[model samples]
Target: MMFKKIGLFVVIVIVVLIGVMTFNTFTNTADDPIFEVVEMPAIDTNAVAARLSEAVRIKTISTDVGDPPASAEFDQLHLLITSAFPLVHENLKRDVVGDHSLLYSWEGSDTSLPPALLMGHMDVVPVEPGTEGDWEEDAFSGAIKDGKIWGRGTLDDKLSVFAILEAAELQLAAGFKPKRTLYFAFGHDEEIGGENGAGKIADLLEERGVKLAFTLDEGMVIVQGMMPGVEEPIAFIALAEKGYLTLKLTATTEGGHSSIPPKTTAIGKIARAITRLEENRFPAALNSPASDMFDTLAPHMGLPLKAIISNRWLLDPLLVSELGKGGATNAMVRTTTAITITESGTKDNVLPSTATATVNFRLLPDTSIDDVVDHVTKVVDDPDIKISVKQGNEPSRISSKSGEGYQLIEKTIRETLPDVLVSPGLMLAGSDSKHYETIAENSYRFLPMRFGPDDLSRVHGTNERIYIDSYVEIIQFYRRLLENTGG
Candidate 1:
C-alpha cells in the first residue's frame, strides 16, 4: 500500500511538471519589431519586365575555361546595363573596378554617414552541357510566357541586379537624394570564384577606407514550406554565413593489371576514405543562428512542434534528430560533407596509379578550418591517403539582429510583405558578400521574393525561371529597402 501511494505521488509530480512546461511554451513570445507600414509606390511594370527580360538574354556566363576577358559576352552585358539604366550611369559615378565588375557610387547629401552597399553578381553558372535540353525554355532565351520569365540567372542573382538598377533609376528620376551614400557592386565572375570581380571591388573599397554601414548580398529568399507547421512565408535573412573549404584527398599506389591487384588499389583507398568521411561526419550542434531562428519561429508554430522547440533544453536530442532528416535543416546545425568530384581509373582492365577526390565542407560558424581538418584526418585514419588543403576560409562573424541595419531590413519586409515571418539564419552557399566582412560592420544576405520547394530546386538546376508577379514583388521590396535605408 505504501509503494502504491509513492507511485501516485510520482505520477502527480510528472503531470505537474508537464503542465508547467506547457504553460510556458504557450505563453513564450519573442519581441517583434514594430514598424509603420509603408506601401509600395506605383511604377511601370512593363518597363521593368522588359529590361529584366533583355538583361537575361545577355549570355554573361562565368566559366572555369579562362580568365577575363572571360568572353565578349561580359563586355556586351556591361554595355547593355549602361544603356539600360542611363540615369544610373549619369547620376552614380561608375568605375570598372575589376576585369568586368562594375561599381557605381551614389554620393549622399551627408558624407559623414557610412555608406550602404548593395551587391549582386551579373554572372550565371553554365547549364550542364547536355541538360540544356531539359529547360522549359532556352536557358538564355529569357522567354516570357505563361506569366513567368524563363532563364538561367533569372532567380539566382540577375533579378537583383536588374531590380536594384530599376529602383535606383526610378528613385533617380523622381529627383530623390539620399542621406547615406549608396554603392552598387556588380561582379561579373561570381560563378567561377569572384576573385577578379567582387574580390577586387572589395579591395578597392577597403583601400579607400570607405567603411560601410552594411552590405546586402544575394542569399536566403523569402520562401514558404521551409518550416514545418507554419503556413506563412518565412523570410530568412542570413545573420551569419558558413565557411567554405575544399580538400583534396589523393591516394597513390603501384599501377598494374587489374588481374594482379594488391590488397587495395589507389582508387579503392580514395573511395574508402570518402566513405569514412561521409559516415563519420563532423559533430552536430544547434549553433547560435539556427537557435535564434527557432526562437523566432517557435511562437508561430503549432502544438507539438511549438512545444518541442520551446522545451529544447529537455527535448534537444529528439529535436536534433528530427532536424537532421532534411537537407536544408541539417545544414543549419552541422558542418556538411559532400564529395563533389572523383577521378581515377585509366581503363577497365588497368589500375590507375593515382586517385583523387575533392571534398567540400560548409562549416558552421565557430567551427574552424583546423577543427575540420583534424576531424577529417582522425576519421579517415589512412596513412596512404594524402590530405591537401585546396582552399579554405573561416566563417564570417555573426551580425547582431538587434542593430539598426537588421531592424531596417525587418521593417522593410513587414511593410512590403505584411504576412511573412522574418527569421535569422546561416547561409549555406557562398556569395560575394563574404568578401566584405571587413568592409562593413554588418553584412546581410537576403533575396526579396517568395520561393517554394519546387522553385528552390530550380536555382542551379533545370527549368530555372521566376514568376512574373514575383519579379515585380522583388522590385518593390528593394524600393522599400532603399527608402528605409535613406534613399
Candidate 2:
C-alpha cells in the first residue's frame, strides 16, 4: 500500500510538469510571429541626400499672413514641388486650396476604395535673428556633412515632404500603381497654426463628399531610451494628440503704497494660485494610445518587465508611479501644466492693482477644457483669485488601432525598418491634423526615422539635422506604404 501511494504521487508530479512545458512552448511560439521581419526594396542613399539638400535650399520659411514674404515664399515652394517631382505632377491631379495649401490626388486602379492621405507641411519656422551664428553651417545652406544633412526643416518636417515626394517619384519611375487612391496634402502654415493651409484643404475635400481612409502627419519619431524596460529602439506612432489650453489667472485688490500694504496683495494671491496649480496636477490614468504602446511592446521586453506590462490591469498604478519618476515618461501618462508668462506690479514701490499669470496646459485625451478649469478653480480656492480659460480646445479624437490605417502603417514600418518595434502613442504637441478631426475618422502622426535623444532635441532647436541613412529609410518606408495599400 505504501509503494502504490508513492507511485501515484510521482505520476501526478510528472503530469503537471508536462503541462507547464507545453504552456511555455506555446507562449514562446506566440512571440515568434511578433519578431518576424518584412522584406522591402533597397533604398537609394545618394538620391535621398541630394533631394533633401535641394529642398532645404528653397528657404520656404513661413511668414506672418500680413507680410508679403509669406505669399511669395509659398508660391516659390509650390513651384519647386512641381519642378522636383515631375512624375507626381504629370500623374496626380494637383489643386491649390486657400492661399498656399497644395493637394495632389493619385487616382487608384480601384475607384471603390476611400483614399489614403499622406499629409506634410512645406513651410518651416523662422530662425531667430541672432542665433544664425550658432549653426555649424548656414541654416538655409542644407549642408551634408558627418553623414548627416544639416538645416532648419531637416527634422521639424521638410524631411516628411521630401521623403513622400521622393518615394512617389521613385515608385512612379518603377511603374508601381496603388489600388487605393492616395492624396498628398502639403500645408504652408503648419508652424503658425495651419488655419489657411490644412484646415482649408480638409474643408475642400469634405465638401466634395470625400472621407479619408486615414491621414498621416508628422509628430512622433523613433527613439532609444524612451521608455523604461525597453532595451531596443521604439518607433512611436502617434494615434492621438493632446489638446492645447491657455489660462489666465488674475488677482485683484485695491492699490496702495508698498510701505502700508494689505496682508495679501494681488501678486501674493496670484503667486499662491500658481503654487496650488503646480502642487495639484491631474491624476494619471492608463488609457488612450499610450497604454496601447506598452501593450504592443510588452512581449518584446525582458521577462519581469514583460510580465508586468502584459498584466497591466494588476500593475497599472504601480507602473504609472514608476514612470512618473522620469520627466519624459511622466508626460506620457498625465496632463501637464506650465506657467509660461506672469505679470504683476508695474512698479517696485507701489502695490499693483492687478496681477495676471498665464499657464499653458497640455490636456490628456478624455479631459475637457471645462474639467481643467474646474480643477484649477477648486485648487486655488481663494475668492480673491479668479481663473478663466483664455484659449482652449478639447483633445482630438483617438484613432482606431485595428483598422486598415494602423495595419498598413505597421506593415510599412516593418518593411522599411525590420529591427525597430512599432507602437502607438499620444502626441504631447499640437499638429495640423487637429484641423481635420471633425471630418476625418482617423488621423495618425509619425515620421519614419530612427534617432537617439540628441537627434530629437535638434528639432525646433539650433543645429537641426537628419542622418542620410535615416532619409533613405524614410523614402523606402513611403514607397512600401504606397505599394502595399491594397494588399
Candidate 3:
C-alpha cells in the first residue's frame, strides 16, 4: 500500500512538470511577420540632402509675435517650402493660420472619408549665442559632410517637415492620388507653446466640421540600447504623449540676514517641497500603451528575459521595478517631474522675502493636472508654501491599437525596416498631436529614421546631424507610407 501511494504522488508531480514545460514552450514561440512584402519606392538621396540643407538655411525660429509679428524668418520659411517642393505648392491648397501656421490640404479622390493629417513643426529652437563655434560646420549653414546632413532642425523636426513633403512630391510625380484626403500641418511655434500654430490649426479644422483619421507628429525617435531585455532595435511609436504642467512652488516669509535665518527659509521651504515631490513620485502603473509595447517586443526579445516579459502575469512587479531603475525606461512607465527653473534670492547675504521654484511636471495619461497639483501640495504638507499650476495641458488620449490607422502605420514600418520591431509606447514629451487628439480618433508619432545610439544625442545638442543613409531611408519610408495610404 505504501509503495503504491508513493508511485501515485510521483506520477502527479511528473504530469504537472510536463504541463508547465509544454505551456512555456507554446507561449514563447516567435510569431510570424505581421505584414507581407510592401513595395518600397526608389528615393533620391542627393535630392533629399539638397532640400534639407536649403530648409536649414532659412531660419524659421519661432519668436514671440510682438506688434510686428515676430521676425521675417517665418516668411522666409514659407517661401523656401514653395520653392523646394513645387508640386506640393501647385497641388495642395495652403492656408496660413494665426501668425505662421501652414495647413495644406490635398483633396483626395474620395472626400467622403476623413483625411490623414501629417503634422510637423518648421521652427527650430534658438541656437545659444556664442556656441556656434562649437559646430564643425555653421549651425545655420546647412552643411553636408561625411555622408551626413548637419544643422539645427535636422533631427529635432525639419527632417519630418521635409521628409513628408518629399514623399508627397514623389507621389505627385508618380500620379498616385490618395483615396482619402491628406492634410499637412506645419506649426511654427511648437518649440514654445503651439498656441499660435497647431492649436489654431486644430481650431480651424474643427470649425470646418472636418475630422481627422489620424495625425502623425514628431516625438520619440528610434534609438539603439534604449531598453534592456530587447536585443534588436525597437521602434517606439508614440501612441499617447504625456502632458505639460508647470507648477510654481512659492514660499514667503519675513526677510532677514543670511546669518540670522529661520529654521526653514523661503529657499529652504521651496527646496524641501521639490525634494519631497521627487522622493515620493507618482505610482508607476503599466498602462495599456506601455503594456502593448512590452507585449509586442517580448517575442522579439532574446532569452529568459523574453520569457519573463512575455508572461506578465508571472512577474509584473519585477518588470516595473526594473524599468524604474533608468531614466528612459522609467519615463515609459510613470509621470516624471523636474525642477527646471528657480527664481529665488536676490543678494547673497539676504534671505529674500519670497522664493519661487518652477516645477515642470510631465503628467501621465488619465492623470489630471489638478490631481498632480493636489499631490504636490499634499506631499509638501506645508501650509506656508503656496502651490499654483499654470499652463497645464492634459495628456493626449490614447489612440486605437487595432484599427486601420495603426495597421497602416505598422504595415508601413514593417515594410520599410524589416529588421526593426514595431511597438507602441507613450511619449514622455508633448507634441503638436495633442492639439488634434480631441478631433482625431488615432494619432501616432513615428519618424522612420534608423538611428544608432550616439546619433540620438545630436538632437537639440551640439554637432546635430543625420546620416545621409538615414535621411534617404526616411524619404523611402514616407514614400512607402504615401503609396500604401490609398490601398
Candidate 4:
C-alpha cells in the first residue's frame, strides 16, 4: 500500500514538470517584429557572372608576408578594376593607400553626417601545390561551367570586391547620389593578415579625423542547415569577432641520443604541456551575442530546442556543456584551442636541446589575451616550459544590434533576401574589419553569400566556386544596402 502511494506521487510530479516545460516553451519565445521578409529586384545575371569570372582569372594572390611592391599580376588586376568600373573612377575620388590597397570616396551632399565604409579584399590565397590538380577546372582558369563560377577568389572574397564596384557603378549610372558619404576600402593582403593593407588604410583614415557611421567587412554568410530546426536559411551578421593569440611554448632540457633520452626530454615535456592544455580546456559560457543569437533563433526552432533555448537561464549549464562538445558552434561560445605548428628533434635518432610549439587561440568575447596566456600557464604548470605570445589582440567590442546602424543593415537584408532569418552572432574567423573598429560607430562582419556545408569547404579548399544564383543575390544585397543606408 505504501509503495503504490509513492508511485502515484511520482507520476503526479512528472506530469506537473511536463506541463511547466510545455508552457515555458510555448509562452517564453516572442517573435521579433522588427524583421520582415524582403523581395530583391531582378539583376543582370549573365553580366555579373561574366564579370566575376574575369575577376577570378586575375590571380591577385596575397602571401603570408604580402607582396609589398605588388607583383605584376596585382598591378594588372588594379588596372582591370579601374577600367572595369569606369563610372566609379570617373565620379568617385580614388586614392591608393599602402601602395596596392584601393580606397574610393563617394562624396555626399552632407559632410556633417558620418560616412559608411564598405570593405573587401582584392587578394586571394594561393592554391596548394599538389591540390591544384584536385580542382574540377583549372584553379586559376576561372571556368564558368555547370551554372557555377569556379576559381580561388569566387567565394573567399573577390565576389565582394566586384559586387561593391558593380553596385556603385550601377547606382552612379542611374544618377543616384548618397546623402551620407560612402567609402570603399579594399585591402590588398587580407589573406596573410592585412598589416600592410587594411591596417594602413585605417591609420590613414584616423589621421584624417574621419569618423565613420559604420563599417561592413567580409565574415559570416547566409547559410542553410546552420540551425537544426529552421528550414529557411539563416543570415548571420557578426556583431563581434574573436581575438587572435599565438603563443610560442618552448621547452629546453638536457639533450642526447633518442635511444637513451631522459624521461622528461624537451619534446616530451612540450608534448605533455600541450596535452594538459587540451585536457583542461577553457570553460564555455553563454556570451551576450550568443545569447541574442539563440533568442532570435528560438521562435524558429522545434519544440525540444525551443524549450531549451527559451528557458536558457534555468538550463544554462546543460546548454553550454551540450553545445561545447565541439565544431563551429563550440568555438562561438568558448576560447578555441589549437596547436598549429611544432618543432623538436633535429634528426630521427638525436634529441634536440630545445623544442617549441605554436599554440593558436581564438578568444571568446568575454576572454582577453592575458586571460588566455594565464589559463594556459596554469594548466601546463611547468617552470621549464616558457610561454611567449608572438602576437595577440583582445576581442572586438560587441556592436549594438538595437542601434540605427544595425537596423539599417537588418532592414536592408529583410527587403533583399526573402524568408531568411537574420541573427547577430560572433564571427569565429579574423577579418579586415578588425582594423576599422575604432573608426566606425559599429563594425559588422558579414559577406552576402549563400554557403552550405559543401560550399563552405571550398573557401581556401579545393574546387573553390560560387553558384550563379548566389552571386546574383550578393549583387542584390549590396545594392539594397547602399540604397537603404544613404542614397
TM-score for each predicted model, relative to the true structure: 0.94, 0.91, 0.91, 0.94
Q: Tens digit of lDDT per residue, candidate 2, span 199-288?
A: 999999989888888889998888888666687777788999998899998899999899999898998998999898988988877787
What is the per-residue lDDT of model 3 for residues 1-487, given as tens digits with 9 covering 90 to 100?
Answer: 9999999999999898667744763577556357766656667788889889988887776545443334588788888889889999999999999878899998888888878888889888767778888988888888999998888899878989999899888889889888888889998888777878899999999999898888878876676776676767777787888888998888988898989888988888888888898899988877878888887777777766676676577568988888877687787788788888888888989988888888888887878898898889899999888888766888888888776777787788888788777788888877888888778879998887777777766776678888888888787877887777754
lDDT of 4 by residue, 353-441 (tens): 99999999999888999999899989999999999999887888889888667888778777787667788988988899888888889
Pairwise TM-score winner, candidates 2 and 4 = 4
Weakest 10 consecutive residues of candidate 1 by summed lDDT:
62-71
lDDT of each: 0.87, 0.83, 0.82, 0.86
For model 2 the local lDDT of residue 171 reads 88
Those runs of model 2 whose alpha carbons end farther than 4 Å from true positions after fitting are 1-44, 63-69
Worst window of 10 by summed lDDT in candidate 2:
24-33
Per-residue lDDT tens digits for candidate 1, residues 36-65, read: 677777877777877888888888877673
Error of 1 at 261 (Å): 4.8
Alpha-carbon deviation at 375 in model 3, angstroms: 1.0
